[model samples]
Target: MELNILAVGDVVSPAGVKYLRTMLRKLKQQYCVDFCVVNGENAAMVGLTPSHADEILDAGADVITLGNHTWNCRDIVPMMEDCPYLLRPANFPPQQPGRGWGIFETKAGPVAVVNLIGRCDMAFGPDNPFLLMEKLLPQLDTKLILVDFHAEATSEKLAMGYHLDGRVSAVWGTHTHVPTADCQILPQGTGYITDLGMTGPARSILGVLPEQSVAGFRGELTSRFKAAPGPCKLEGAVFTIDTATGRCVHAEGVRIHEN
Candidate 1:
């Protein structure tokens, strides 16, 4: 049987959550998605809040993954323990509040979702994701595994894809907020993408107002960053996996703009 999984990129701002509320279900229905995972670290102004997580879950996301900004909202630390479906980077110190991976029941059977953060150029400087995966994979009971690799460098994301090629069903990159055109099935049957882009304002700079982003880049004093107003766009990928073999048969990038 073929299982369709929809992996959404970082959700930024309240506008991003609004977009999901309006379109996520339609997207799932349109694609006949069997499972859905969303990177929601940016669901709030900087990091996700408990309410934002609830909003995404109510909007139809089956699993919510986070990255470096996982602790941006201090309140979410405790909420993580209560919400098993929400995952923080697995490489975080073992004492962290939330889990890095979990097996969830889906129409296609049990599917394992692992969340990891890249060490290169990251603020958290978590452990090596490649080595962490090597340790985690041996313990998972299901072959239908999906990984959300949140990193800044394209090289790191690509390296990870190759590192876990045949071992997981798919490895989708997040955090860059800009989508790449390299979605394809790896030589070993893993569906890979450099980045899934982001679900938020299409005109802004990584979901922040263009002027705000430019000010930061130009070394000019600027106020706190805020989500840009106006139309929002959703970016992600859909992977078609063969459940019997736990291999990706097809992968396609998804881009939707609010009409």
Candidate 2:
């Protein structure tokens, strides 16, 4: 049996959420996706609210993963505690509001999903992700494990992919918002992608207003970044995993442009 798992990039702003509402279902159906995970930390531009999480789930994500911005919205704290489908970074200290990984029942059986954040250039430090994984892997009961490494450095993300090569089914990077072209199965059979890109404004700077990002870069300090206004596109990748072996046999990027 083969399962097509889709991992979407960070969704930025309310517009990105609305765009996801409009496009995700069709994309899943088009790709024959059996399971889906979406990074929704930026759904509210910085952090997602409970409503944002709900909307993303309704849009088609089986699991909603978060990143460093996980706590930007205060309201999500309670939701995080209640929703098992919502995950924060596992390395975010044991006392955090929500879990960093989950095991959900799928047609192929139980699929374990792990969410991790990186420490390199991210400004804040969580527990070491590599060390956390060592503790996490032995605890997971399922062979079909997926990891979403939300990190800033490409080297860090690539290193993680190699480190977990044969251990997990697929390992993908998020948070960069820029799609990476390196999509392939590692020598150990784990599917890997440097970054899954983002599912938001197509013509903006990482889902932000171009002018705003430009101004910030030019030392023109702004109050806060705003999401760009325009047609949105969904960006992600689909990994075809062999359910029997819990290894990826085929990997490819999937991008849907709003017409």
Candidate 3:
């Protein structure tokens, strides 16, 4: 049997949320998606809250993964514990409020989903994701495993893809907010991509207003950053997994501009 899974990129703002709410279901149907995961750390422009997570879930996200900004909203700390489908990076301290991985029962079968952050050049320090996976992978009972490797560096993301190539069903990168052209199945049957890009404003710098990002880069602004205004775009990937063998049969990048 083949299982179709859609992994969406970071949702950046209210506009992005609106776009997902309006279009995700249609996309799922169009692709015959059996499962869905969404990176939603930036759903609130800066961080995510419980309400924002709810919005994404209601919009059709079966699992919501978070990244570096995972703790920007205190309310999410508790929500993460209560919401089984919401995940923070597993490499975080064990005492962290929420879990880093979960197993969800889907029509296709049970799928294990993991969220991990990269340590190199990241804003916050976390345990080694590679080592953490070594311990976590063996614990999962399911073979249809999907990982959201949220990192800033392409090297780290690529290393992770190769490391888990034959072990997991797919490893999709996030956090960079720029989609890469390289989307392919690894030699060992894993689907991989450097980044899934951002699901937010089409005319912005990584979902933030270009002017704001430029000002910050130029050291001319100290104000808080804001999401840009305009049409939204959704970027991500669709993975087709061979459930019988727990291998990814196909993977493709997907980008849609809001009409």
Candidate 4:
């Protein structure tokens, strides 16, 4: 008893969306993935008129998780609330706009997915996610659990992963555009990755204009950040989990270039 889960990093722009929409289904088929998830915080980064969060879902994503940039356009919050598949952040605050975690009915069973954020170097409220999960998780009745820990610091993300190991099926980190080298199944049968990376103009500086990023660092001036218009790349991973044992049999990272 198992399921194929493909978790993507951030989708940064229209090009990123187009590319992911074009390739994800094929990728899922090739990998025999059961469910697909993506971080859509940057889908409207380059532009906002064509907020294609739905388009990405139409393509194949079962769930789309967001981060602090989730509120970048201001229009997405309400829309996210209307849809359970699109999450802002669970650990945001009890009264926040969108839900932090949910369960989707699948052929395998109901898969519970939790969306959490880290406190270090991020806009997080006083609510402690570690405590919140401990309190709220038992109420859910799914053993095949997965989490997208969106955070800025690697240490905090790893800490949370370790804390939740053996309890959850997988814990994959996001928010950071760069994917880390660490992707492994925990001793307790939990799949872990420091970061899934972003699917965007990969050559740029973390999805932003390299020139602007460099100028801001070099000069004492505050520069308006923007996304770079160029070739894009998709970064994510497939967590092949053995449900009976709750261990990952296969852990592979993928990168698709818009060439």
Candidate 5:
């Protein structure tokens, strides 16, 4: 038996969340996805709120993963501890609210979803994801494990894919907000991709207004980053895993843009 898992990229602002609300169900149906995981740390352009989390959950995500911006929104602080479907990076301090991994029941059996953050260009201090993964793997009882490695550096993401190649069903990168073309099944059977991209304005810079991003880079202290307007797009990837063996047999990146 095969199970199709859809891993959506980080959502940027309300625009991204709106796109998910409108298209995620149809997209899941189009791919025959059995389980869905969405990276939603950017639902508010900084961090998502409880309302944003609820909308994503209603948008058909079985599990919602977060990254460095996980604690940016004060409104979501309590929800992080109360919502089992919401996950922060596993490598975050143990005292932090919420969990980094969870096991959910699915028709294919129990599926485990792990959220991890990287230490690349990100200045935030968190435990080393690689070492944390190795320590956490033995604790997960299920073979159908899916991981969302929210990292900025492509090399780091690729290294993580290779690191857990045969151990997990699929490992995909998030936070880059640019879909990668390197979707493939690793030699050891894990489905891998450098990044799944972002679900928000397609023409913006990582879902923020391009002009604003340019200004900030130009040494101008631009106002707080805001979501770009106009057409929205949803980007993600689909991994077809063989349930019996807990290995990915096929992997493909997907995108949906509003006209």
Candidate 6:
């Protein structure tokens, strides 16, 4: 009784959407993926219209997770209420734009997928994930729980993973966009990864052209970041978890590059 959960990295623009379809279209059968999740905080950087979010949903993602940039596109706020599948950081103030969790019906049963933000250098939200998760875990009727820990600090992500290891089925980190070397099943049975690599132009720096990001770093001039175009790369992981044991049966990193 194992279920495949494909978690994709940050999807930034139209090109990114195409990459997702191209790379993940074969995954349903190839990976036996029963559920697919993606982070879409960067969707509108190339200027996300509401159409951008819809495109991701229509492309193949079952649940679209987001981060601090969730509110970047103001128009997408209304989409949140209608599309509960789209989730922003749960720790965001209660007045935030999107939901924190979604109930997914899988072959095993219903699974709870939570989108959480770390309170380090990132957004200073009112709710605490450590405290909030303890309360939220009990309320969920399903044992198969997955969390997307989007944070800037490595300490935050790693600490959270240790904290929730036995409680959830898997804890996948995002936001940095660089895949970490650490990936394993925790003592408590939860599958864990420090960060799932991003899906975008791999040659670029975390989805943006290196030159552009470097310019900003140098503080020479402010430049609007754009998704690096051309051949793409998809980065993330697929975790198969047992419903009865609430443990990961298998966990593997997925990296596909399109030339």
Native-referenced Cα lDDT, model 2: 0.95
Task: Give per-residue CA lDDT, model 2, range 49-134, as digits (tens).
Answer: 99999999999999999998999999999999999999999999898788999999999999999999999998887999999999
Local distance difference test values of all predictions, in order? 0.95, 0.95, 0.94, 0.82, 0.95, 0.83
Error of 4 at 140 (Å): 1.9
- Candidate 4 shows a clash count of 1
Model 6 Cα RMSD, Å?
A: 1.5
Backbone clash total for model 5 is 0
What TM-scores do the predictions have? Answer: 0.99, 0.99, 0.98, 0.94, 0.99, 0.95
Better of 3 and 4 by lDDT: 3
Candidate 1 lDDT, 45-106, residue by residue in tens: 68999999999999999999999999989999888998999999999999989999999998
Q: For model 6, how does the per-residue alpha-carbon lDDT over 1-259 read when each residue is reduced to its tens digit?
A: 8888999888766777777877676865689899999898776653345787787888788999988787767788788878888888788888766689988887889989999988888645547888999888888888899999988888888899889988889999998889888878878788988899887787888888788899888987765787776788888888999989778878888888887
Candidate 4, RMSD to the unseen true structure: 1.9
How does model 5 score by TM-score?
0.99
lDDT of 4: 0.82
Clashes of each: 0, 0, 0, 1, 0, 1
Please identify model 2 stretches exceeding 4 Å from their true place: none
What is the clash tally of candidate 6?
1
How do the residues 1-259 of candidate 5 rate in per-residue lDDT, one tens digit apiece? 9999999999998989999999999999999999999999899999989999999999999999999999889879899999999999999999999999999999989999999999999988889999999899999998899999999899999999999999999999998898999999999999999999999999899998999999999999899888889999999999999999999999999998999
Task: List candidate 1 segments past 4 Å from native.
Answer: none
For candidate 6, give the lDDT of residue 166: 81
lDDT of 4 by residue, 100-138 (tens): 888998778888888887788864463677888898779
What tens-digit string does per-residue lDDT give for candidate 3 at 108-127? 77999999999989877899
Q: For all the candidates, what are their Cα RMSDs to the real structure?
A: 0.7, 0.7, 0.8, 1.9, 0.7, 1.5
